[model samples]
Target: MPFRRRQLLALGALGAFAMQAQAAEPAAFPSKPVTFVVQQSPGSTGDLVARALGDALSRRWGVGVVVENKPGANGMLATSQVARAKPDGYTLLVSGSTPLAFNPHLYPNVPYDLRKDFSYIAPIQDAPFVLLASPRSKLTSYGQFVAAAQARPGELTYGSGGVGNSTHLVMEMVVEASKTTLRHIPFNGVGPAMLSTMTGDTDLMVSVLPSALGQIAGGKVVALAVSGKARVAQLPNVPSFEELGIQGPPTPGSLVLIGPARMPQPLVERINADVRVVQQEEALQAKFREFQTQIFSGPPSAGAGRFLREYEEWGAFIKARGIQAN
Candidate 1:
């Protein structure tokens, strides 16, 4: 054989051997421990859900799942970390609407692009925002809250996880629809923002249902209204914004699992399928119910589409309201 032909044949043989070797490697995903990066504080709803899902996944896969809380910069810290991580399915992000949908619109220079930087794995849950007033405050109902806001304008202060987060944006929508104004007090996370209302540091806040449930039950705060289309079962007495005559699309916050972009398609499908199975478990469902979370597990494409839709909706809303981060 000619020398060049022999060299080509040898290279082809080596390539075939490499492909066969790679195919023979273990097919089981999560061969090693998995890390879920969370963008909320330890006790926040996002953190709680991440830990719960991680525990369930660990049980299912027989591998350890770690929940890391890296809360700061309106969730940019953990989000950017996950966006830059290797797309090996080992490093994941348990993020809410903020990082994936709302932040790019709210910030002038977000580090990562939602469409280009991450792979949507699965949606975990969706919880409506609940308007809460300090138990000490006289604002006891949605009507009273609206009236007070209109009467006082910027005198009425509201606390939120942060500026540009779903918590803040939802409240802004409510205020706009009500034709009222409220001072925004941004905090590091829902836990701190809820605490601000409980301590009367802020007059009111619109927080995710799960994060505010404990406070509402303990009488530290009063449930004024929920931002869902209907009243939340956990707080039946609390009216929804629609029932209060406020009109707009429901502004529920969502939590989704994602990984760095360009992850293997098979790996994404496997993880998403497992998440759906875990979310449907009776025990997990009950646990999430107790926290006022409604499971929303679905296909990765659906999750991606929802994220994109929310990005456009929130971007328009923020611009219309002239909302800006502090």
Candidate 2:
């Protein structure tokens, strides 16, 4: 053979050897600690779920899992941070429906686009909101609440976690459906909003089942109706908005896991599978029930589709009612 031909043959052999060597290397998906960024305060529902999941995942992967709380801007702060993080599957986000579904329609300029900036990992859980009235108020049932609102338009005050949040939007739906006007008082978080209602600062407020569970049990607030398709087991006596002939979104909020966009397909599948496995455990399911949330196990695409539907549905509602964040 000619000198150049021999040189080419030798290079081809070396290339084959390199490829074989690379193929022989072991797979190392999670060789380091993983971080889960939660979009709520330490004691919030989102934080609790994230910590539980992190604990389970850490045990499964035999690595440390850290949960970081970045609570502000209606969850925009934590969402933006995760959206911009490296898509190596190390950084993830555990958040509720506000940032993913409602924020885009509520704000003029959101920091990140849900479809473009993040990958939907899997849905964790979903829960309904209960319309609670101050015990001091005479609004014991849904009918009385509406009648009072209609009788005194803009006189009844309702508090929410914040402007453009699930608490705010769900109450807006109730007000529109009943054709009554109520003053809105947006608080910093659900805890404060629940407190305001219990203290009679606000006449009524819509709160997540878990957040309001204790208050309802303690008789601090009276649950007039729930914003769900059917009555929640925790509040069996409380009627649902649907039963009261109120048409609106099915649930008040949903929680989902997400990661930065452009994650490797293998990594996405692995994480999604692991999440499903984690949610299937009996212990975790019972824990989720304690939070008044149902465990969600579905294809990764389900989360994305739900987000899109909610965005459009809420956008139409907000536009029709001219609801703006305060």
Candidate 3:
């Protein structure tokens, strides 16, 4: 009994030593440059938005901020990278509605359990959808787009970024609500779909504003309507789908930041605070608007909670639409 007690005491001492060693490790949380991984190609609206915010953070925090582009894999490549990253603050993600909200519904076997694998840092911004048609086409407004489509019945084609994307679902919901029919053209990306519209490869692309802005300004494509509650500031004259008497999905996509789950609450709070400050910088906001997007810096820890509700709602919506995850 005496020998057993000594052995037990030694084991307890070793455990204590290990705990203390871990706790004593210098908390130089971002002692080095931090990497912000994004699931978008260069020049993409999401990528540009991330760079703007990253520059601001670099200036304010005095620590180097690097933006890495990790496109493709349906954002799964970057999402998985951020999900499996250490809970430390060094690695982060400029997550969009793709990985944060829609992926849960679109992927049959999501690798990272959102609720369990992520710590939502802060809501970055909203990317509203715009329903646009080719300029050479006769369609002038949402009503015209719908009426022309109904007249031809599946003869009109609408382009999408890809399957399970916000643009795809937006068109689906709009067609279902307007009681009209149109052919669906799934493209590799928004750029390709928009190009198809410009070349008359497709009738229109229910894409985000950034994807269609240049062509709209060039008169190559027509500005149909914004798919939101209010008019976009960039195109003040444009009306919303609601104004066109068409109601579908509201607030199609947004950009947000999140880290791996089990992140220390203190570290999460530090990152959230710094990021919120960066999101509100006047210069950053200006650049964001240049892309026709808005920044969202909500309460400190509210992002995670918001994501939880958003995930549940988006999942239900996808299921209701009978959209398969594949």
Query: All candidates' TM-scores?
Result: 0.90, 0.92, 0.87
Per-residue CA lDDT of candidate 3, range 71-184, in tens?
886788899999999988778888876666778788778788877788877778776777788876877777788778888898989888888777788788788877888888
By TM-score: ranked, best first: 2, 1, 3
Query: Count of backbone clashes for each model?
Result: 0, 0, 0
For 23-58, candidate 1 gives per-residue lDDT tens digits of: 444267778999999988787788888888899999
C-alpha displacement of 34 in model 2, angstroms? 1.1
lDDT, residue 150, candidate 2: 92
Prediction 1 global C-alpha lDDT: 0.85
TM-score of model 3 vs. true structure: 0.87
- Candidate 3 — what's its lDDT? 0.79
lDDT (10s digit) by residue, model 2, range 1-326: 99999999999999999877644442476799999999899988888888887888888888998999999999899999999999888999987878878888878898899889998888888777888999988789999988899998999999998998888889888888899999999999888999999999899999888888899889899999988678878888999888998887655467788999988766777788888998888778877877777777788897887888888888888888887765
Best by lDDT: 2
Ranking by lDDT: 2, 1, 3
Model 3: lowest-lDDT 10 consecutive positions: 21-30
List the global CA lDDT of all models: 0.85, 0.85, 0.79
Best by TM-score: 2
